[model samples]
Target: MTKAANFIWYELMTPDPAGAASFYGAVVGWTIAAHNDAAVGGVDYRMIVRGDGGNAGGVLALGADMLAGGARPGWLGYLEVADVDAAIDAIKADGGAVQMPATDLPVGRIAMVSDPQGAHFYIMDPIPPEDAVPGEGGVFSVTEAQHVRWNELATSDPDAAIAFYKKHFGWGQEGEMDMGPLGAYRFLQRGDVMIGAVMPLMEGYPVPVWNFYLGVDDIDRARAAVTANGGTITSEPMEIPGGEYAMNAIDPQGAPIGFVGPRKS
Candidate 1:
């Protein structure tokens, strides 16, 4: 089993699944396949199959019930936990809030939760195949185009948010960088790999949330495709510490996503 507190799944809830599929297919070269398993949630679930034959993520249409409840189209990542109910209790005890109670789904039991600073994510106990290898599903062998390369969190209170995750998810602080008046940008690790960082929410951010960055072959090329395919480019390619570059954007259905890749010299 993949250890608890590891980010195991990514899902996008959008009002237009077809449009999102087409826009992201162009953006990341993913081949979208409808998940029609009768045991599963049926037609609303669509799998994002990467060009290399690995499952990247899934696209779920925001249903009527969610819309009536004021749920907006967005992306949600799932962190694997040993016990869903136990994790939910810990989250609540630590001053976090539960948007949805733990419930049984076709693939697992999951609960939607928000951190103390209000960034939303899920805790799931997934049901994998009987013969599946441990630590295989939802993990990438290499950082490449079409795979999730990084995870970033912007929150109102970075210290409290980090402490909350550390308590329940076993997340460790690898290191941090002081960004002057913006405070410290803290790197988070599941074990060895630096999965992402947590920082204070920047100006103009709608809300505190986690943003996952998908890798691409070329950041410039991905930016071009995004604007040409009905997506809005929020930021151009900017070089980061790792020698590569990244950009952020909103998909056609209003869900924000990001891309990271090399820039041709």
Candidate 2:
């Protein structure tokens, strides 16, 4: 079984997949490959491939039906689990809501869910090949410079949110940082690896949600590429504790994303 609580996949659901793909390709230097889902009787999807030919994530075009049903443009992360159905049940029992029930797909059984504080994520039990081994290919490595590097949660109740996820995914608090008025930023770990953090929503953040950061080689250049490619840089690049820098951005379609990298200077 895949390791539980490891984020195995990332996806972007957008009204303009072609445009979003183009914009991201320029900003993050990813190569987009089109994948038709006709075999699965679903809409066309895309694979965001890294330079090494490994897939970083996917781009899914939202249909009119989905938009009419209130599905907006956004990015979602899929966390691997041992049992999707059992995970869904555990989430519900912990005051969380089931957005989509566990359903079988070509890749795995998946369930869309939200925590008690409304932070959304996916629980997936991925199908394995006969010769496949656990902990291979599906997840990005911490050393990978161009894949997803960090995940941040902006929630209504950081304490409750952390507890809800910990109960289901076995996440532990590694350590925390005081953000002064924004309260404490609690870092989360899966086993020994620090996967991300959960913190109270800041003043300007719209809602409780998970924000993913894509690692880049140069924060300054990536920030420029975002605006040059019709994306908006919401926050200018700022230095973090490790001497790395990060910036927040909004794609032309309005989906929020973040970039982290080493400063060229």
Candidate 3:
């Protein structure tokens, strides 16, 4: 099945990709591979392989030019679409802005865009390899570890944001969980599975952002690894549905990250 409107890839843009490799390798148990693809603009881009040997995403090294140009460490997800150009057009018409013009790569055509509310993400129409199995999805999974488990958005306007995404990406606001004072945590579903949620921007976040959650085997162990490897646990894991725990953190390089798993410890 074509994953239109679904997340097809995840990426990390950090000033220190080497240190990020060590940080994430410890916290998430990912093995970073050295890949020198000159087509990638001569950056030290590395593929992140989970314990299952399948890649979950890539780590992009932020060049000096990027940092000097006001780029900061953050995680960006790629939302797959049927037509990259058409999507860009719609995004603009709907009050969104294009941060980077659509660029074609060997893998597929991609473009960095922000929603009307200013939460940034990518939209791609990937070109699968000849050996790629038909209709198979990678990187983002609902029942896998290491791969991104959920994609959450913290925006200024939850209602308008939901409407904008629904109108453009074919996403459905299936249901919501009440969060009391913080407002409702509206779940965003592509089909039957709940991919993630959208909520009001929390106290310290200030600006709108996208936070992708990485699945782990043990939430406590993952928290331990974060502090051990120079990362900071900003939120303690709280048990969610299915008895799993989720928490937020800031990686050593200042990129915000999240994790979800059982408390085996």
Total backbone clashes of model 1?
0
Off-target runs (Cα >4 Å) in candidate 3 are: 1-4
| Superior by lDDT: candidate 2 or candidate 3 | 3
Off by over 4 Å in 1: 1-4, 34-37, 139-142
lDDT of 2 by residue, 200-259 (tens): 898777779999889888888888889998999889998876788889999999899988
Report how far off residue 89 is in candidate 2 (Å): 1.1
lDDT of 1 by residue, 1-265 (tens): 2243777788888878888888888888987774434545544787888987878878777888878989888888888888888888878888889998998888889899998878999888888878766545654423678888888999998888887777787788778988999888899887777888998999867789999899888888889899999999888898888799989999988988989999875
Model 1: how far residue 33 lies from native, Å: 2.0
The estimated TM-scores of all candidates read 0.93, 0.94, 0.95
Pairs that collide in candidate 3 are none
Worst 10 residues of 3 by lDDT: 34-43
Query: Which has the greatest TM-score?
Result: 3
Query: What's the lDDT for residue 232 in model 2?
Result: 91
Which pairs in model 2 have colliding backbones? none
